[model samples]
Target: MGVVKDWRDKELSISEVIRKYPHISPFVIIKTDVQRRGVNYTEKALAKVDPDIHQVEYRGMFREKGDATPVSLILRDGTSILTAFSVEEGKREPILVDVIDDRIVLVDQGEILEEVEYWEKPDYYDKFTSSGKPMWQIAAARPQRIDINPNQYCQFWETPGHGCKYCSIAATYNSSKENKPKILNVDDIAETVEEALKEPGRYESIFLTGGSILNGKELLDEEVDLYIEILKRIGKNFGGKRFPSQLIGTAFNEEQLRRIYDTTGLTSYTADIEVLDKDLFEWVCPGKSARIGYDEWKRRLYKAVEIFGVGNVTTGLVVGVEMATPKGFQSEDESLEKCLAEAEELAKHGVSTVGCVWNVAPGSVFFNQMSPSLEYYIRFADGLDQIRRKYNLNVDMDNYRRCGNHPDTDLSRI
Candidate 1:
């Protein structure tokens, strides 16, 4: 059984939560809830998808069973609902996707909520790199961003109990026999980006992230070198010194960060802390805690602000992991209070916090663990957005357009 409780008896319904937080965007709330409780496509709904136009192939960190499924859904207001298509261990049922009036609409309990569109495949998605690798396999596309995961597997999972309990990167990579290239060829990535940029206003920015690369002369030196090489190649396309880009890599020392900043057109940086509470972090992400420690991770983020500038440096939190049973906080109130307090502290140091709703995956250690209530997610996102506003920080790199995975950053558009 999942750790999530029957919140219907304890908390407000989705409509009630929206009613209470009237200031929050109803579309964002619906997106958040849809992400929290994933979606299932009916036969008619799946038929609406055009594999050539709509994104139907799996790329990046996660892998699905078949060759195709809608990559993700897009709300009418340009809000991207980036979620996996999976049932959460029978803990909760996903909302239904059905065709209504020749449009795809999300259905809950037989009621149509809103119309949604599948993410469209970019022009480069069907092309092949000079190296004979499919360009789509090398890079993935969002509504306004081109995502490149050069390093697919994290080294932290090598140890018995090191990987983050809530993460499924290692499992996904291990099971993916077809997607074999672990680290992307720099030339292929550059070629893919060049082709993607030719699609006449299809992409706005480039985003890169992957599992932690722990091997280096000094902890993450090798990892830093890899990004510098990739960024330099990607930078060749742009004539300017810096292009609109973001790298969500592991926390590196000042020297390592400066190396990438000085060498490439990389614009923004992020190092996900995963969880705010130190104790819970150690329990949930033992590898991260053991390799870099919680305090040092924050220090790296602060140092990144010095080099990358304020608003350009951010940290992501797997919100609600602090409520994991046994090791996590016991109550939602306690978890929310503690998390926001820590987020506030980071914001004071010119670091913004972004929230990614925790959807316990089957491959994760916390697969059976339940996430927090929908109310908790709304309050958490609100708190993080308020913190960024208080600090006068901008999350343009990870905002609604660039990377729409975070609910907190999604608030930046409004």
Candidate 2:
């Protein structure tokens, strides 16, 4: 076990950690910290942003929004840094984007980091859905992926106090519910995806995820049906062939998994376990814990492997949140050991794990809680990558090119 560093051990600055891990890509380390610390642009940096060619706002899954920070960032190396406008409690000084020497760089304190570019706006973003809603409202653009969030309000939030503690979905929904639909209109989704497909090579995958819908004769059945209908509509552009797509939703039973797999054109499956430690999962994701226990969730993931096939299934972890204050693991060493071990267990079952930098968002219950140190996150990402290599598991299903939110998978490019 790595007992060398305590969870509360002095945190390292971005430069210090980068110098420490020479084997890991510095771009990845910078990306992780940018996400961990959150980011905003100076007037000069924002001046370079042309809304006609750059994506200024992103919706659905929670990317920080405020006073037009240009949605998120893409490094010169193509790693996506999904910036949050504000971070929890000002735990770490927010990373800055400033124009220096006629180039945009991510700034930390007085030091300049890397030159980065804003994610480009897709050709379809400026158009409107057939329903008269802006197309960007129906589908958000990632660098090479098309993201469609069918529903924004998680059913888990419907039960007070059950939503994931680090999630802002419930809060994001309540505040915007009056303006947005709880569930998207299927026709709008199909029309937007169809229009997006017209851009040819602009998108590598079509991704769908939304708040979990827990009602049905069998749990997650309605959620399965929802995905089936939407995927079928989008699949029309593919001419009866299975499409490159993924669905991140509730961990459903084998029956539900087969229902979607047998029906839709989705090619991969992901059910975020959130935290690897069972207790941490129970504490951090109370709704998932209550509805689908830890062991049951893993069992469902394994069952997905049987259905989706090996290497096509993966789970995500909110990296540092396993050590969230109070109920979370108290020591970084212990947190790393337990999380890596549990991740290895999942890897053994053909379920590769990916880590999302724990950005303590404004609306989450843990918004005031601090995230883990940079060194801890760097080590965690390397560890998950090593585990996947050891088990011969491939994360291409959600790798850097397909989905850039995960730091661990970004290492796979090396």
| Candidate 1 global lDDT | 0.86
Highest lDDT among the candidates is held by which one?
Answer: 1
Per-residue accuracy of model 2 over 253-357 as CA lDDT, tens digit each: 998899888877889999999999888888999999999999999999999999999999999888889888898888989989999999999998999898888
Q: What count of clashes does model 2 give?
A: 1
The lDDT of each candidate is: 0.86, 0.85
TM-scores of the models, in the given order? 0.95, 0.94
Candidate 2 clashing pairs, residues 3+ apart or interchain: 7-332
Positional deviation of residue 365's Cα in model 1 after best superposition, in angstroms: 0.9
